[model samples]
Target: MESVKIQNRDMAWHIAANIQFPPNFDAAMTWATIIAVHPFGSCKEQTSGNVYGKALAEQGFVVIAYDASFQGESGGEPRWIEDPTQRVEDISHVIDYAVTLPYVDADRIGVIGICGGGGYVLNATLTEKRIKAVVAITPVNIGRLFREGFSNYDPLGALAAMAAQRTKEARGGELQVNELLPASPGAAKVAGLTERDVFEATDYYKTPRGQQPGGWTRMLFSHAQNTLGWDAFAFAEILMTQPMMVVIGQKVGAFGAYRDGMEIYGRSTASKDRQLVSLEDWSHYDLYDKPEPVDLALEKLAPFFKKHLNEATGQ
Candidate 1:
């Protein structure tokens, strides 16, 4: 694994990434590359991205796991803001950088998106034809998840609150930060989060199991402002043409229990190949780092990318 910095198109921010090469990798060989996108408010070093990068690298694919601009070690203003459009562009910028490497086969580029990143990957591939295959694990359409409540509850009040907050910010009110997770294990229970929602996530992000200095629980209030009308699957019925695979947890309890993935699968009409894999007895968070589910996801990912990318590039 190697840490490197690449400039975004406007030269406004330096994207930080960890590039992993397969064991005994040879610079003379043109290897397939995979961009592993991290979840919201997370970085390149976060558990899901790191685990996926390493796992794919071991299987002879060059993997690049990167911090989205404005978060982690990457450069940008209004730190911790989550803009879905910018997040989709971030994958393209990383691809621009990846193709410059001598050993990378540009035509064989693929991507794996974890959590909200999955939604962005789907959005990115709409016009980024260089990506030959895509894998979405326990995907969430962040914008929809925020605009419509996870359980499909109305978000009129929430949208009104965000509009008011934005006005306050424009008037020089201090930016408000919203927590992505409960403040404590006890707080999760008090918030009425089931054991499935809190257990794995709390252990990974809030505890020592996978916590990192760059990981944070809060995001700028502007994130909500940006996501109000964004839809990750806006053009899935027409524009999403790449071969796609979606991995979801069968026992997930959050966000209507895998409804997002189902909608994505249903709407993707142009994919040459599309599949939905449900991991039995797994919750949404379980796909992040739990060995059983992560391994199962990778097992499905390796062959999908290998077959599609190889077919595209004749590798």
Candidate 2:
């Protein structure tokens, strides 16, 4: 794997990324490319690069896993903000950088988005025509998630609090942030959290199993300002014309990825071809780093990208 820096053209931010190559990779010959987008509050080094990026590269494709602007090593101010617009644009910026590499087959470029990254990548496909294929694993639409709080909690009240907090920040107060989960499963259980999504996510993000500085699983509270009014699949039926594969775990909980995946798969009426792969045993968090679940997702992803991208490039 090679460390690389991609420039987010619109914001002039330097996005940190890890580019992985197949064993005995040849720079003289162009190869299909894939950009892996990490989950919200997670960095490139987590499942994005360490899992999907490396796995995809070993399958004979060049994969680039990047930290979203403002979250990881990427350059941006007011750090930890999850601006959907900037996140969506980051995909194109990475593509722009990918095409400049000699060994990358720009025409055969594809993308895989994990968790919230899945939603961003799906949204990116609407305008970024260069993307030929997509894979959304346990996808979450932040907009919807924010608008409808977990398990029927009132979003209006939450949004109102955010507005009040922003007003305080505007008055020179410290910026407030939102932590997605407890520090550990033990902590979650003690807090009376019974949802599988809650404990599992805490285990994954807050523990050494997947913990890293960049994937701390926290975001600025005002992020809901952008997310509440946005919808990742807003116009996907019309503009999302690429081949897509939506993978989801059968365990549907408060996290809502299963619902999001099902909704997008149904709404993407314009996709040239789309497939929904559901795993019976795996929960949403299981797909993050678990070997069996990851392998299950890759089983569909590898051939999907290989077929669509190679077909598009006639390679």
Candidate 3:
């Protein structure tokens, strides 16, 4: 594993990334590479990204996981803002860096994304044909989440809140921030969050389990403005030509995300192949780091990438 800095075009920002090479890697050998995109409000070292990156590397794939722009170690101003367009572009920028590596096979690149990162992966693959395959675990469509509540309830209220926040931002008001997870376990219960959603996130991101100094639970309210009109599934029918896989927890409480995944799969007419795997016992966050669900997801991902990215035979 090596830590490297990649500069985006125009040199406006530097992306801090960790590239993991398989054991006994040789510079002269061309190897398939996988770029892992972290979830919302999380960094390269976040539990899910770290776990998946290492696991995929051990499976003989060179994997690179990096913090998105404006968050974690990546360079940007107005920290913690989650702009959908920039996030999608970040994946391509990472690919831009990966293709330059001596050992990377530029023709055989794949991508994996968890949580909100998954949706961005789908969006990026719409136009980035260099990505041969894509895997999304417990994906969330931020645009749909902004337009419709997590559970698709009280959409009017959600829209009104986003409008109010946008108006305030236009007036040069102080940036409002909101927590991605409950501040305390009790707060989750008060907000009607499921037990799995509450404890899993708090334990992984806010406690000693997998916490990192740069990991944050807060994001700028202005993110809603960018996500409000962005649909990750847009152009799926015509542009998502790569092989795609979606691994979702059946019991994921955020129904809007699950619905969005289904829509993406349904509309992806250009995919060479498409798959949707539902883990009956898993929840949204469980696939983030839990051994059982993560292992199960990897079971599917390893073969999917191997089949699609292997250069021996065109997939």
Candidate 4:
């Protein structure tokens, strides 16, 4: 449970990170680094990633959990804005730091993304070579979210609306802010999430269980949204040469999450190492520490990292 400050290039932005390893870790396993990303607008401390990281550390690896850019202790302006591009960059930056640790094998570094961060790590793996393995838990393909709503309508329309808003802000040096999430559960949210989303998010964000005031994000970013058309990989097209692990829950309709993951899994050239684990009664939010659902994902996650980190994999 050791925490430290990791400074980013801009604004001397320093992310608060925790790295934990087993009490009697063996050096023979090679140094393994786990860079964990939390859901949008949430900090590293308030995530399923933290608990999961500790779990992995108990198996003998240094797990690095940190605040995503502009959230928690991390630095940025008009905070809590979703910037898909920057999010990927943040993943690379964390790996950059991971390799610097003396115990880090450099060749054995991997990543884990929770919620939106899951989607971010999926995209991040495409260009980064240092990262050898990846895990996306209940990832959100923001591109799809903006192009079509829960009903699978034109989610991109929402992103366009935000883009238009940014255009106005760019020229005028001013902006009209909007709510971070939907007004409330309604007929609009595609996943029938209006009610459940408001209700649960209120519990996580408003209550001490996961509350952190600075964790709130803006309705839009100052940059482009990772929509399918312009995305590095549309929901289905991005390919990777690295080993990736995809986990999706089954409690609800998970078409989009699994759709995006399978799309990548099919395109990835990596052989004999890709895995897709499905939980029987899991939902998208369940991977974030929902009681019954997390058990399934958690059950598989530790062993996945342990097998790769401790066993003979990359040599």
Candidate 5:
């Protein structure tokens, strides 16, 4: 694995990425490339790069895991803004960089997106046809999340609040940011949060199990405006034509990744070969870093990517 910097094509930001090569990578021979997109509030070094990137490279593909432009080691101001439009474009910008590499087969590009990244991948594939295959692991549609509410809060009320906050900031008020979860599972329980996804996310992101510098789950309260009206699977039934694999855990929660996965699969009517795999015993966070669940997901992903990537080239 090696760290690389990719310039965003549509923006002024520089994206920080980690490129992982197969054990016996041969630059003389081009290989299928996979772009691994991390979850929201996550950087490349987390599950995307450290887990899936490394594992997929060992499975004989070139994989590059990257931090979103406004987050992680990437260069951007007012950091941690989760702009859905920019996030979707980041995938294409990564493709622009990938195709320039001598070792990459431009026609055989694929992508695997975790959590929010999964939703971004779906949206990106709608227009970026260079992507031949896609994997959405525990996908979450941010727009739907904002619209439906995690804690069952009113979406319109929250939108009004964000509008007010943005106006306040414009008028020289303090910029507001919020922590995504409690300090730890213990603290979450103390706070009277009983949701399984909430506790699991806290365990993974707030503790040593998965916590890191750029994965702090901080969000700009006003910037959430980008997500309120956006839909990751918008027009997917008409535009989502690539082969896809949607993996989800049966344990649905406030995060609603399972619901998003199901909806994406059902809506991507144009995808000739879309598969949805549900791990009956797993939860959303389990697939993030758990060895067993991740292993099961890879078993499906490795072959799916291999076949589609190779077949795309008629090999």
Candidate 6:
């Protein structure tokens, strides 16, 4: 239940991480580093990253759950901005801090990313060998999620918005948006009354269980520029080289997305260590903090880390 604030290199931003360590853990005996990424608009603590980090901490790993830049307590201007490149660098910086900690086993580091954070982890894993394992819960391929269902790779709309927002700030500033539609504009809106993309997001952010007021913000116009295919499907070739564990709940309709990854894993001539696990009657958000899937995922995952720690350490 300890937390620390860290400043990243490149003057990117200062990130606040909530860390948890196992009772009487030693740096030399089975130490682990976990980096949990939150969904695009959510902060580190308000989402599943912290929830699962706590669970893994109980199992003996040192979990570091952090807010992505420009969102949450992390520093960045034009709040709620999305930049795939900067966030990936942010991941590297977090890993940098983890390695320097006496209690963290630099060689056995892993990452846990929930929702959109899942996509960032994938991007980092493909490029950053420092990442040994990945546990993506109820994940969203941020890039594909913003592909507007692949309507097109067009970027003009997004660029224009960024310009407009910058101009407005230069002239005068005000809160742009309080919340965005849960589903993309192209996403099939749920059949019902007042709500964003889904009832759960609206309920989650508006209610105490998932709500963290003053920490949420609206999307930057076409913010998709940073996410739309933000190296999503493109990274599969590289991802096949790492050990990846995907946890998908039956609801949230993400098995297909899970399969998307499994198919890639299947093609991987490099990594046969990949695994796909499903929880019955469980939806995407169920794994966030709910009992069933969270317990189920960790039951299987903690052991995976235990066995993989050796490979991570080359022992």
Give the number of the best model, judged by lDDT: 5
How close to the true structure is residue 201 of candidate 1, measured as C-alpha lDDT? 70
lDDT to native, each model: 0.83, 0.88, 0.83, 0.67, 0.90, 0.67
Q: List the pairs of residues colliding in candidate 5.
A: none
TM-score, model 5 to reference: 0.97
Clash number for candidate 2: 0
TM-score of each: 0.93, 0.96, 0.90, 0.81, 0.97, 0.83
- Ordered list by TM-score, greatest first: 5, 2, 1, 3, 6, 4
Per-candidate count of clashing residue pairs (backbone under 3 Å): 0, 0, 0, 15, 0, 5
TM-score of 3: 0.90
* Candidate 6 minimal-lDDT segment of 10 residues: 184-193
Off by over 4 Å in 6: 27-30, 149-175, 181-197, 214-217, 222-224, 254-269, 312-315
lDDT value for model 2 = 0.88
Q: TM-score for model 4?
A: 0.81
Judged by lDDT against the true structure, how good is candidate 1? 0.83
Q: What is the alpha-carbon RMSD of candidate 4 to the true structure? A: 4.1
Q: Write the per-residue lDDT of candidate 2 for residues 1-315, one digit (tens) a residue.
A: 899887644666698999999997999999999999999889999988899889999999999999998888898878888888889988998998999999998889999999999999999998898999999999999888878863146777777888999889899999888787887888898999868887888888889999998886878886557777789998888998999999999988787999999999999989999999999999988999999999989998898988998996676
The candidate 3 region of ten consecutive residues with least summed lDDT is 150-159
What TM-score should be assigned to candidate 1?
0.93
Residue 80 of model 3: what lDDT?
A: 86
Q: Any runs in candidate 2 off by more than 4 Å, and if so which?
A: 150-152
- Candidate 2 lands at a TM-score of 0.96
Candidates 2 and 6: which is better by TM-score? 2
